[model samples]
Target: MRRRTYLAGGASVLAGIAVSGLVSRPPSNERLLEAAREPSGTGEGSSNTETILSGTDHETSLYELDAPNDGPTAMVFGGVHGDERNGIEAAREISDWHPDAGTLVVVPETNRVAVENDDRRGVDGNLNRQFPADRGPQSELAAGIWDAVESYQPDVVLDLHRSLGIYGLHQEFVGQAIFHSPDAHGERLADRLNEDAVPWYLPFHRFTPGESTLSGPLLFQHAARELGASAYIFETTEFLLDHSTMVEMSRLAAAHVLELHGLLELGGDA
Candidate 1:
């Protein structure tokens, strides 16, 4: 089934018809600045690399940090929409945290052009929509971002975003809710997070499958099916939670995912 939903003000829709049978190839001239096969630390090691997307001047910083012991890898993406500063800030803060067991990869600003200009759609259109594709003439920025996601090969993925409307107030918008793919993986995480007092949640909903709408491309949806990993696109209502509170919630959400996979240990442990 396919559904097309709009964002705040009905300006953009998150509906992207799921694309099938598309072959994905890295953009030409895509190069990683790092030389190591794997990051260099045994425990709590971290490394930052710069990715230069061949044709554009846009540059993205990639961060990788491993825990003290072995565990699953979780990937976090922020700033898919340049105007959502909360998710971007949340992502940037998480990159500094040291996990206890697994690997954490973070791209704080996925759409640098949009983020830099505080625009929702970057120069190359919506970055989130142009993914899992076989071609270019597409945004070089989107192509570059896709290359990074595919190369990282995460066990789970999270794309962070912000919504202007409250879910309860605006039935059409995904505000104050977890807009996830159809999967138990995301449901489980959402259930746990919603248990908090004055919880920043409405209900769990699925994105329109197959193709791009106002909402752009569903990144986690493709990642979940193609990569065989649990994935979600988390949205926070801008008015529901204050900036600091939103950041805290984002941190908690990431921690919950890591803890669920045994990659992180919080508080005093059970």
Candidate 2:
């Protein structure tokens, strides 16, 4: 389903106050949306693309969207597992969007080899599991991705994926869920999606927010632990929903996170 667009007003007075260093408070969703819709006075919201792991088998494009205003930075990833095409598509779409405030860094196909082969992992094993908590990334590909993360120093990190079944229904699968770090706003994102994007007839498909397992060597977990960034892993189920719905769900999750971090506006339409 196509998302509904919201017509926003002028930039909020709250944003002006915050910019002037007169008050410190979280901007309301409406205010953020308004601010994001406003034109950046500076011609700085330009986008650039670069190659990650250049001249290597795992090479992929990395897109960076810099807004005219200075704000928090967000890094988004997809294609960690090749079979998860929804996330890959959503990330690719997001790569072309323009952020209104902070920078947006996107790696649409993190594991290019796996994506090409339609497999879960590349020859070096699961790319998602290569980032151990105590040490540097174990594989060359993982290390290159990690290097980008370190260089950007993003305030938020979002990893998108797909699962074969619902998170609670399937013992090993974690879909229709947002696994988040302690500092992340997973619950809020879940609530927003459930209220707007989810269909009433499919109550079972509603998004859930859960605390991420720190025991695993997941990229989101590693970023949260090491950089203290708000990190999340958004998963959509493939059991009942069609491919398009899954892509929409992943897109909504990423857009909402960007909105929550004041990087974008009207996430429902983003």
Estimate TM-scores for all models.
Answer: 0.71, 0.83
Candidate 1 lDDT by residue in tens digits, 24-56: 212210111011122324544655656646457
Write model 2 residue lDDT over 1-270, tens digit each, in one string: 111111011113222322232112224433443444454545548889999899999889999989987889999999999989999999998887778788999999999999999999997999999999878999999999999999999899999999876677556778889999987898899998786566655576688999876657999998898888999999887665667778867876777798888887553443
Clash pairs of candidate 2? none
Q: Please give the TM-score that candidate 2 achieves against the real structure.
A: 0.83
Worst 10 residues of 1 by lDDT: 27-36
Alpha-carbon error at 265 in model 1, in Å?
2.2
Candidate 1 residue 148 C-alpha distance from true site, Å: 0.9
Best of the candidates, lDDT: 2
Model 1, CA-based lDDT? 0.61
* RMSD (CA, angstroms), candidate 1: 12.3
Which numbered prediction scores highest in TM-score against the true structure?
A: 2
